[model samples]
Target: MTDPKISAFYVAVQEVNSLIQNGGTSSSRSLEEKIVEHLENAQLLGKLPKMGGAQEEVFMEVTKHGLRISAARSRLVKLRIPLIELVLLTTFVDGFGKTHAVFVEKSTTTRYQLHLLQLADDMAANVLCSLVKNAFVEAEEASALIEVIEPPSPSIA
Candidate 1:
């Protein structure tokens, strides 16, 4: 039997994809807002971290050598290394200054990991921030559809 939580999460993801495909208006609720609302309705948000707390910013300095992941403070152990059985949601800049968001899920007791989501734009950074704040509960359900939507590239100023 399929897990109800997983089913609900996929439904929410499809809804977000529909909104994006239809070219939702500025007055309409955004994909992030819709995702949060669906997750809330499904009672999955409680399993995740609460938003609006004091966040420890970990700056990923873009360099020619490639971006290295590091924690800004010792208290944030999750940022220090690639963790297992945990969700990683972070944003970084490429050498060209374009921002990208990545989501990874690591398996416990193994070196296996899944790169579930990646988006190249600032709006994705905002979405990634939301996902991180919520501890990425049910984020795996959205993984399949994430690649299908191509958000417009960030315009260089």
Candidate 2:
């Protein structure tokens, strides 16, 4: 299932591009095309610790605060990748032509997580990415709306 407001991705693989720092490589091709190219060669990794299932059903929603990932059936949020924590967002296309929404998250100063989410189509991929990007911009604007000020000190005695 997919929606403009949210996207449901079958998490085909996590940590697929863990070794890469910037969330896959740069490409001059269209976003979807770049994904397809990487899909052929992206590293195959084992299941993440505590994350079972060949394909994990997760729902992703971009909010004012961050990007939310939740269990589809349970509706329990697994993780929220804050705007400040997101490294980069990229997408890929599987051989079947499904869209894979890839995002790198900075879990800690020393740890990063790469997620390969398989979306139903290209439109969902576009919507999700746009929302995430917009959220980041909005958050930055909100933070910069006001600046701290200090009153001048009284004249020295």
Candidate 3:
């Protein structure tokens, strides 16, 4: 049986990719706004896990080595992991605007890999590939946009 968490992650990725692919031309909302709305809706619908509280933050960074996914629970502490530890099994983009990526943990030999879905236009796909490649170049670290935000305020009000 497929893991529910993985399924939800795939769904969220697919929706985000679709929005990026279409460039929000057909929707009244801008792409940035639509992304935030979609994320909230996904969490509400149980397609993505909800944050435990206002202090929790999750982010992904493409570094000179590999993708780093980090979860910060408190203001000063975070856990970061490398995405390359997962083996990419397969990837495909269909004519129907669907893209699928499968990955398995490096320690696992199972045929099944975590599945990720996305939508992308030709331009977006090219750009994504280029960016990923650049992320692996050691020199790119100087130019990469990292650590975008400061710690959130303890309270909004």
Per-model TM-score on C-alpha atoms: 0.28, 0.69, 0.33
Per-residue lDDT of candidate 2, residues 84-157 (tens digit): 88877887565545567777777777776666777767888888878887888877787777444455789998
The residue ranges of model 1 lying beyond 4 angstroms of the native Cα positions read 1-84, 114-118, 135-157
Q: How badly does each model clash, as a count of residue pairs?
A: 0, 1, 0
Candidate 2: C-alpha RMSD after superposition? 5.8
lDDT of 1 at 134: 41
lDDT of 1 by residue, 1-118 (tens): 1211100000111122333344366657754444434434443435322222243334432222222233445423222222223343445543335453443333333332322122
Worst 10 residues of 2 by lDDT: 43-52
Error of 1 at 108 (Å): 3.7
Compose the digit string of candidate 3's lDDT tens values, residues 20-117: 45654767876445544554466567775333323233333445445433443333313222445533333444333444332333333322223233
Model 2 clash pairs are: 35-92
State which candidate has the highest lDDT. 2
Residue clash pairs of candidate 3:
none
* Highest TM-score scorer: 2
| lDDT of model 2, residue 86 | 82
Give the deviation of candidate 1 from the true structure as CA RMSD: 18.6
Ranking by lDDT: 2, 3, 1
